[model samples]
Target chain A: MGATFMLGELVGGLRRNLSMAVSVVLVTMISMYLLGLGLLAQRQVDTMKDYWYDRVQVSIFLCVEGSQYAACAGKATTTVQREQLRAQLEQMKPPIKDIFYESQADAFKRFREQFKNSPLADQATERAFADSYRVSLTEAGKYEVVVSTFQGAPGVGRVQDQKQLLDRFFAFMSVVSWGAIALSALMVLCAILLMATTIRQTAFSRRRETGIMRLVGASNGTIQLPFVMETLVSSLLGASLAMGLLWATVRYGVGGYLSKALVDTAFIGVGDVLAVAPWVVGGVTGVAVVTSWFTLRRYLRV
Target chain B: MILFDSVTKTYPKATRPALAEVSLEVERGEFVFIVGTSGSGKSTMLRLAIREERATSGSVLVAGRELRALPDRKVPLLRREIGTVFQDFRLLPGKTVFQNVAFALQVIGKSRSIIRQTVPETLRVVGLDGKEKRYPHELSGGEQQRVAIARAIVNKPAILLADEPTGNLDPATSREIVRLLDRINRSGTTVVMATHDHEIVNEFRKRVIELDEGKLVRDQVGGDYGTTTSAIPVIRLDEAGEPGQAGDPGETGEVR
Candidate 1:
């Protein structure tokens, strides 16, 4: 019966202060939405990094006809020297996943396809390209080992890792994620302060009722339970709204644009969003509950 | 029952005491009137009884609990046994008359069955059985006070304290309120009324304890309003005679 009474008081109090209650819900929703966006962006960055890094290869370009290999005693890297390099690479089987030899003609053909729409496609020739061996690693971190080993090889002019070419993209994403996180933190702080003031005003408006409750032998917990429950209700409502918004963004917005833009790589799968949705819900709800509890404690003393 | 021994209350930053070395006793089921002009310690005495203010130097025992030594957590429990009605009525403006009365039982964690049975009965006792849906603002001053009385007595408390309960009502309404308090007293609830309304005091003729400059000046049994002549002899005897005579007068006058 006491619990029913308290629940009734909480509902009745919310009804009495409907505008402030709505404001609290809206504030929490916006704050959590921004936070969710930041988290989703970070997840996207991780997914992209995993997808692209797995396919990155280190390429070692062959020395030219008049280069150091031609002047050496081996002279133009005989079959013996080629076999020696191949054996050395084969020995690194655990770290070097696979090695593919791209002759000068194959390199020229790839360059023509890459710039097919540009004027540079007409000027590219098979003899102008370098014969290179592409090395795929089991992990991105092992790229440096392959690059260093091929640097002073008898027939190698230069070794380049494709992972380095993607540095600018990851740097840009890092800046965006940091900005989002900072803005989300500021907004969450505002939401907490707003929630505190709303609860305080609600309690003040009902001071007469609370005073009577105090005089009539109501426990401090009993008096405070209603206000705390009210805050929880507001927070839960806001979190639910934010979750819905996030789900919609992931399903409609990102699925339509981002997935198509990065067709070859996985861009935030629905399963990943579902896996992290509860955490977002729990995080927003926890923040709302804690902020409301502290605020009400100051004003209601319960 | 209530007992005070050498109770003294001094406010911070004030040289004079609000209540100075005062001692009094009220027996069970007794109706006593505490009377004094404004600032004469009438409200302070009532505050002490309600545990709102602690005495500086003395002990107060209410229903076998030492109030002066009681912790803050126990103060609310002590209040549960004592019902307080202020001049302001203090009804929650948002609640209906029914809810206002039901709140008393709700606060003590009473069962729904008890609340359903007791709230309407208490309201009926206060003569507001059919007006349960009205808010306090909609009720007249007399009706509001009746609602306040219903709330105070709904818990079946041991003591009832009313601080100028009729201060906002007309004279006729004030008499009606006094009658309602007397009716509650008849039902065996001890009532302590602090009022300066001489007409109500004279008509009721209950025990009146008057305070002057934080001192207990007169304690008369069957005391009438504006009749200080009978109190003078008792005071003179209390000052000049033996200490035993002081205690005798309280009993003798009370008996008469």
Candidate 2:
């Protein structure tokens, strides 16, 4: 019976202050959207790292004629020198997981295919490229060992680990992910303050009823439930709206454009969005309900 | 039934106590008036009875429960047994008279059938039978008080505490309100009214408990509203200060 009364009052409170209720809902929606966005961005960063990091290789470029590199000042890579380099890599302690030798012709063919649309492709020739051995390691961090053992070796121009090329980009992405998470946290704080203010206004507006409720022996819980429920309802509505927006973004924004646009690498699918939707619903609703409970405690003295 | 045993309520940083060493009791089904000036602690007496404040010293017992000993959670349960009507008529402006009266029952978790039957009957008793559909603003001052009375009595409380129920009404309406209270009293509920209305006090001739500067100067059966002629010699300090807004009575250690 008390539950019914409170339910009635909750509906009544929402009706009495429609504008404030809408404000709570809107603020909650925006905050929850930001929260979901933060999670999605972190997931995207992890996706990119996994996709790119797993394929990183240590490329050992062999010395070639006319090479200005100091390591190549001795002699151009002979067939015996190339064969000896391969033998040394095969005997590495960790053992190269995979290794492939690319001749200058193979390198030029790949470069032409990569830069097919660029005019730089027409200016490149087979001799313009360098013969190199691409080494795939069991652990990418072992590139330093490969670099020390092979640097300045006979017919070796330079050992370039793919990890270095990707590190700065990954680090920048991490900073962006953290920034997003921090911003989401700040937005949630603002939403809480807005919820608290909205509830306080509703409580203050109906204080006469509350004072009488207190006077006539209505329990504190009875008085507070209505106000708390008002906030919860608004927050729930906001969270639900946020999830819908996220679903739409996943369907059209990510699945429609991002995944297709970044065809060369990997992109998060709708499955990732589906996986995160629950937290958006559960997390924001939890925040709303808990904050509402606390906010009501301060205002519902009656 | 109510009992105040050696209860002295003093506010912090005040020159004098609100109620000084006062002890009084009322039997079941008694109508009593606690009359005093603005700072006479009439409001404080009602606040104490409702357990809004713990007594600074001594105890206030209402309906067989000592307020000081009552746990915080149980205070609401105690209030359920008591009805209170205030000077402002504290009606929910947004609600109709019916909703206002039904609210008391709803808060206590009363059944829908019981609320439906009791609310209308209570409203009828206060001469507000046809005004149930009207909002508080749609009703007159007297009608609003009647709605407040209906809300108070719908729960069928043992004691009805009226703290200046007529303070906002004109004389004619005040008399009408007093008559409604009288009618309620005839129904066997103990009505404790605190008022400064001289005419109603003289006319009703109920038991009057007068407080002059927090001291119970008089407690007599069928007593009239007394003037300064009945006032006892007590220190007058902060005559303009509000006793109702005083500090909590629980802090006995604060008194020096």
Candidate 3:
């Protein structure tokens, strides 16, 4: 009897306050959608980092004939200097996992292959290319060790970590992701405040009913249960809508557009959204229940 | 059935006490009237009886239990055995007459079968048998008060505390309400009514407890409107709207 009566009250309350309930749904949906997007963005950054870091290498470019670098001193690298650099790198085997030497001939061949369709390929010669040692690190992030050791050494014009440039891009992505999460936090706060206000207004309008219920010996739990359930149902609706929005974004927006446009980089998929679904729904429901309970306690007084 | 032992009630931030060490008791099945002017602590006494407010220096006992010692959770159980009515006829405006009465039972977790049986029966006793579908706004003032009475007594409470149940009705309607309350009281439920209606007091001739300036000035069995003066004189509309003579006990010691 209690369950059925409570269900009836829940439905009736929602119906009577349809516009308010819809507003709750919409606000909660927007907030939770942004929150989900933030979570997915964080995951996407992690995936991209894993994909790119495994392949990153530090390139030590050797001085070529007539090079302008101060280390080159406008002289070509000698066999002794080249041999000394290779021996030092070989001694640092713990940090340097593998080394491959690309001669000027090889460098020019690869450069032409890369820009074969461009007119610039016709102007480049083997003399224009620099002989380089590509050093793969045991740990991709330890590029600093190699750069600090070999920079401006004899026969070396420059030491560049491929991961450094990638790090700046990744840092920017991290900022964007955290900014989205922060904005989502603000939206969730707004959702809570709006729900509280809706509950307050409902309580005020039904003050007479609550007072009568109190007089008739209704327990606080009985009076407050309907209110909490009302908020829970509306918020759950919003949460489901948010989950749908998130799923669609992952399925079409990321998979269909971003994956096709940036084929080399991996993006978050529907499975990642499914992983974050429980936390988002659970969090929103918990907040809605607690907010309504506190609002009813302060306002309804039954 | 009800006991107030030296109940002294002083509201917060007030210059004077609302009820100053007043003591009173009404036995089982007694019909008692608590008569006083505005702010004479009549409502305060009722509120104390219902555990809405605690006595500052004394205790109140209802249905053989000390209300001061009652926990907040158990207060609802205590209130279940005692029904209350007010001057404003506090009915749920959105509910129909039947739903308003049934709401009292629903909140207490009564079964649907029990509610279906009890609501109509109680409504019949309140003389609202056919008007079950009418809302509070659609009903007359007297009818609305009847709905409130029906809601109060629907659970078959042991005591009924009415704080001026007939205050908003006409003289004829007020007498009818008082008669209905008298009928309910005769059915073995203790009735404690606080009112300023001299005509009902003089006609019904019940036990009267009059409070003057928060002091229990008179407690008389079969008391009249009293020979004492009041801040707001009771207008006797039943006597062709002419103000009745104050300070006259007319007749006493008879429960007619």
Which candidate ranks first by DockQ, i.e. highest? 3
Steric clashes per prediction = 0, 0, 1
Worst-scoring 10-residue span by lDDT in model 2 chain A: A1-10
Off by over 4 Å in 1: A1-3, A64-84, A103-130, A164-175, B11-15, B225-256
Candidate 3 residue A113 Cα shift, in angstroms, is 8.6
TM-scores for all predictions = 0.85, 0.89, 0.88
Query: What is the DockQ of the complex in model 3?
Result: 0.59
Higher lDDT: candidate 1 or 2? 2
Find the 10 residues in a row with the least total lDDT in model 3 chain B.
B247-256
| Chain B TM-score (each prediction, in order) | 0.87, 0.88, 0.91
- Number of the top-ranking candidate, with lDDT as the measure: 3
How far off is residue A75 in model 2, in Å? 2.9
Each prediction's DockQ against the real complex = 0.43, 0.54, 0.59
Interface Cα RMSD in Å, per prediction: 2.0, 1.5, 1.3
lDDT of 1 at B37: 60
RMSD of 1: 7.4
Q: Write the per-residue lDDT of candidate 2 for residues A69-105, one digit (tens) a residue.
A: 6788846888899999999999984647888999888
The order of the candidates by DockQ, greatest first, is: 3, 2, 1
lDDT of 1 by residue, A1-302 (tens): 37777778788888988988898889878877887777788888888899889988988777545433432333354567667778888998879999998887888898998788889999876756666778889998889899878887786667889998876787788788777778878988888888788878878888888888777777777777787788788877987888888888888888888778656767885666676678767876777778767876678752
Better model by DockQ: candidate 1 vs candidate 3: 3
Q: Which of 1 and 3 is ahead in TM-score?
A: 3
